[model samples]
Target chain A: MSLDFGLIIEQMPDILSGLWVTLWIWVVASILGAALGFLVAAARRYGPAPLDWLLKLYVEILRGNPFLIQLFLLYFGGPFIGLRLEPIPAGLIGLTIYASAYFSEIFRAGFQAVPRGHVEAAQCVGLSRSQILRRILLPEMTMLVLPQCVNMAIILIKETAILSIITVPEMTMVIGAIGSQQYAFVDAMFLLAIFYWVLVEICDWLGRRAEAKLSKFRFAVT
Target chain B: MSFKLFELMLWAAGYTVVLSAISIVIGLTIGLCVCAAKLARSRALSIPATVFISFFRGVPLLVQLLLIYNLLPAIGISVPSVVAAVIGLSLCTAAYQAENLRGGFNSVPKGLLEAADMVGLSPWQQLKRIRAPIALRLTLPALVNEAILILKASSLISVVGVIELTRMAQNLSASTYRPLLFYSVAGGLYLVICWTVAGGGALAERLTRTSRA
Candidate 1:
């Protein structure tokens, strides 16, 4: 059989609704993940030695395994720990945890790459620890890390598709349900591709814009 | 949890490893061709390569898998779940790998190639003796990193009905009604496999470095 544009148009409502859920999850999870990752990186950098080791383990275990398994553990295994959650919450938390692990690594690298001399110079000038962090470290690291954070965000966007497996009603799941019922799996897949491709492109464009803005800070600081 | 259950998990882990292994090999071969096409001067060759990379890289792998699984039948070419899964993983990884390979090739020193030309080395000789080796070395760490990513991503194949490690965990957990134990065990197994592969990659890199030196 030939391709059918008509089927896609007919299912536009379902696709749009699905895409809304995708964007919601993507935005919420990304913001939470980035915030949490920043904290974890900062803690690892300036926290006590034992705390640093524990945080490193946290980063490793999360990063080492597949995210699908993590989601499974969080969602399916939640009841055992008396932490039952709806699919949306579970998806959000899972994605947050997964994204944070990656984001923290990026943050840590950026934080470390700010030369030691820069920090020492700030200290020599009698800058308070908080002052140095806010005035000197964060700006430099943000410029260095923004591009990677954007890359991770794109990866996380792709990952939001997996939440569909847990019945999250995201684009993948919605399209998948339509495919099964209507036997228009090919058309459904086509729409899914378009939705996801556009999402990634939007994310990429925003990233480039942010990078352009931040480069001025980078130049000023250097 | 039980010995029998753990054995089943290991058995399924075999599928995960084997599938990732097959896909990486096929992806590398395909990636090489795509990288060549992308770096080629002709618009006819480069344009399609660029589109292939853009579509594959831009779209999610989950969608690609679903598309392959469903679209094949519509085109009168039905494939089994495993084949569809392999095609999806290979193509998706190929796009990323091609980009990586292209970056590696692009970084090869122009002066070195010119020096080879001065010695009267043919283009093929130049590629074999100089460009290929240098590009391969520069690309090695990225290639290893990609391999690990693909291994972790192999979990998504379960969506297409391949009973790899993640699928087996879901199955065993559902049957035993012990999601916590089974999922944790599965996660641990994945950590072990990933660490081992990462170690092997590190070893390989060291070997190549020392041999070259």
Candidate 2:
């Protein structure tokens, strides 16, 4: 059977509302993940040798697997460890940890991107270590990592779809519910695809804008 | 976890690798065709190729998997779970691989094509003798990166009822009341597979490093 465009139009508002759930999860998860990642990167960069190696192992374990499996571990598996979480929180935690893994690596690369000579020069100016990190390293690393972070954000947004599998009632879940209920699988799936396409396109546009703005600032500084 | 549970996870992990391996090879073939289409001077071919790349790369693979699994039957073409999963992963990876190969092909030096022309090489000869080797070399690292990404993403196939590694872990964990052990073991198995893929990539990179021409 052919698609009923009128039904799709009627369901636009219900479907579009999933957009907020998606954005909320993405923004909250990214902020939380990036914060945790910053700490981990700092530790990896400046902590004791053994701590750094341990941190590296943590990053590798998370990075080497799929976020869906990570979500399962935190959601289905968490209660075994005396943790019982609902879907949203379980998904939020899982997404955060997953994002943090990649973010830690991105941040480490950002840290490395800062030339050693610059940090040494800051130290030579009699600035304290914390002062050097705050005034010199953080700013530089933010610029270096902004584009990569946005890219990760895009990936994470796409990943938020997986949260629906854990019954998060997010976009994909809502779409599936509506589609199956009305026997409009084709229309529903196409609509879902389009919605995600628009979202990803916006993300990519924002990424380009941030890159442009950051590069302009870097040029001015130099 | 018990040995039986561990064995089950390993069995499912085998499914994961086999499925991903099938998708990567199939996707690579599709990607090469799409790359060739987009590279051609004809807008007729390139426009649809560009749209395919944008659509596949733009949508999330989970959604794609669900659509393939569900929509095919809606249209009276009911495929198996494995077929649907493979289609989803293959098309999704094909888009990314096409772009990577396009980049590799674009980076092939113009001077080499000109040199081939000067040597009286035909178009096919130029492609075989100069362009293919250089582009493949340039894109080898990207191919490896895509392979790892696919291996990890193959986990999503579970939603479509393919009892792959992660799904196997879930089933075993639910029955055994040992999420921690099964998941950790599953994670370790995934890491080993990924590490091997990455190690192979590194080895491939090293082997190709000395070949400049």
Candidate 3:
């Protein structure tokens, strides 16, 4: 069978729809993941012994296991637990949990990078712990953490493709469906790869811009 | 439900180890070659090598695996799903490893290469005797990190029906309807593997420091 350029082109709208779904999931999950990551990092840093251990365990479980399994559990096993989430919500939950673990590590590193003197200075000024963390620690760590957070965001975007397995109709699943139907698997996959590549390029561009803005703050400190 | 789930978890853990080993070896070998090519003098060779590294490193492993597993059959080159999984994973591993190796190579002082040249060492001899040892030392931490990443990424292979640890957990969950128990076990095995690798790397670093002293 010969390649059908026309057929592949005709399917572009369908594939683009899936691409939008993938992007939407990534954006929502990344926001949630970043919020959760900050909380996990804070708990690990200053919480009680049990809370610290619990946070550590949560991070390790999410980090060590594959996102695919986590997605499987969330999507397929949710019904058994009486949750009964749809594919998109399940995908969002899985990606957010998985990404949070990694983002927490980045946040931890970033927090650690903030000079101890800065925190001490805040303490000497009679600032409360929460005030010090909010004003002094966060602004200082933001520069260190922003690049890594952006990189993790890109990774989260790429990982959203795995949701296709749970029948989320993400870009990969759409390509697979179109390929099987048209028997133009190679062409379809090639096009799908280009789509992902373009998405990644855009993310990289944004990451670079963020890095540039953050690095000015970093350099001013050094 | 409990006993059966325990048996499945044990079996899956074993398979996870085996597949991780295979992918690591394959990834390292291909990674070395790709690294060498990227550093080669010829633009003709290194240009494509650069593109290959960027492409694989940029794309997600799941998409790569799906494309390979599904598209190969369409081209009348029908390998088993496992074979495709290995190929896809190894290629991704090679890409990341190549970048790490390049960093390793960059860390070698230029004076060391000049010294090797003055000693009349053949290029291959210099590479084996002088470069490889130093590069390996410099790259060890990064390599260990990559190994950890590979171990985690191997779970993506389950999408194409490899029945590795993650797949086993999924199956067990289906049978017993105990997602938490089976998934926790699988996650524990992964923690063990990752912790072992990190611990081993730390030990090696300590040992090397002592030896240097």
Candidate 4:
């Protein structure tokens, strides 16, 4: 109930450093996740019968388990298996894998959303498969993918808080350390919540802009 | 893993499922009310609902858990870790379920309500016959989705000292020095539980469809 803004201001440097860590994790997770997702999505879309089942199983396993457990498995289990990893790398790998599962679904849906007729039309016009994919499919899929990717970006930002449970020096952990040290429990938590809120709101705003652009794409197509 | 170890994991996962189910049920009830408020004509009723949904949705559940765990001491209400965990999960899930319910209800056509009104149906009858069923049906898939997410998220309750499945896995692995075995068991348990939930949801949907038909 008693919030001291001055206390928060005093702890600003620590909080800012925590924010920096969170930002880098978010960016790396997004890039790595998106890369893995595109690969999985492409394989799922184009690969033959047996590979479909294997790829689907990979996606299912990741989706079914919680991110925290995944992190524990990597952070703790990796060393046992000779793949020794630091906390930062373990956290990053865990998040990237988790994000890829969710992102792959989005990417798959984006691919599916592209109209089949357009691809057929491109083929009829003598465009090669890769050319058609680049020109027609990629453009249309980007319209759908951008907004969803933005959404996943927001989710990933919030999820980085979970990394703190594994001792990843993120904002949430920093806020906790500050809160208990200064007994500004309420103030520290309030600030932490606001930090996450602003991050998500920015992502949401960008998503809306992308969504608007998508509608314009559709408008132009029509 | 040994049989005893696997059994321990199963037992821990059972706790995970029970905690998640309790919270999900409570969240569904709370979500119904919040959804009702969000749909209400009165701004006074709707504004608080909006705030609740926004605050809960905007903040990550992990932070919420930590905050609530700490908040109880400040408020002179000392609850056990399990209680704190459930409260955190329930409130957080309620926010999401509320949004899901709102989305469901919003999909109910205005024309349908107008028709009900023209037929002189009372508010209660209209809600019972038209609004509730349509909304629940619309919300079925989302409800299932949220349930699975909460089940997975229940892992975070370990931070509050509930020692749920994931925490149990962490401890067992750290102690036994067989991280691979314990973590794999934990992952398998989660996957099993999730699929069961998903299968049940699919069954319920099918049953409803057949009964209607």
Please provide TM-scores, in order, for all candidate models, with all chains considered together. 0.95, 0.92, 0.89, 0.95
Chain A vs. native, model 2, TM-score: 0.92
- Native contact recovery (fnat) for each candidate is 0.95, 0.74, 0.55, 0.73
On the 0 to 100 scale, the lDDT of residue A74 in model 3 is 72
Model 2 clash pairs are: none
DockQ of each: 0.84, 0.71, 0.55, 0.72
Error of 2 at A45 (Å): 0.7
Question: Which parts of model 4 are misplaced by more than 4 Å?
Answer: A219-222, B210-213
The C-alpha lDDT values of all candidates are 0.90, 0.89, 0.84, 0.89
The 10-residue segment of model 3 chain B with minimum total lDDT is B204-213
Q: What lDDT tens digits, residue by residue, belong to model 3 across residues B14-114?
A: 78778877887898899999999999999988998898898887787887887788778877998988899989988998888998999988888888889
Docking class of 3: medium
Winner by DockQ between candidate 4 and candidate 1: 1
Report the number of backbone clashes for model 1: 0
Give the chain B TM-score for each candidate: 0.96, 0.97, 0.92, 0.95
Worst 10 residues of 4 chain B by lDDT: B204-213
Sorting all predicted structures by DockQ, with the top scorer first, yields 1, 4, 2, 3
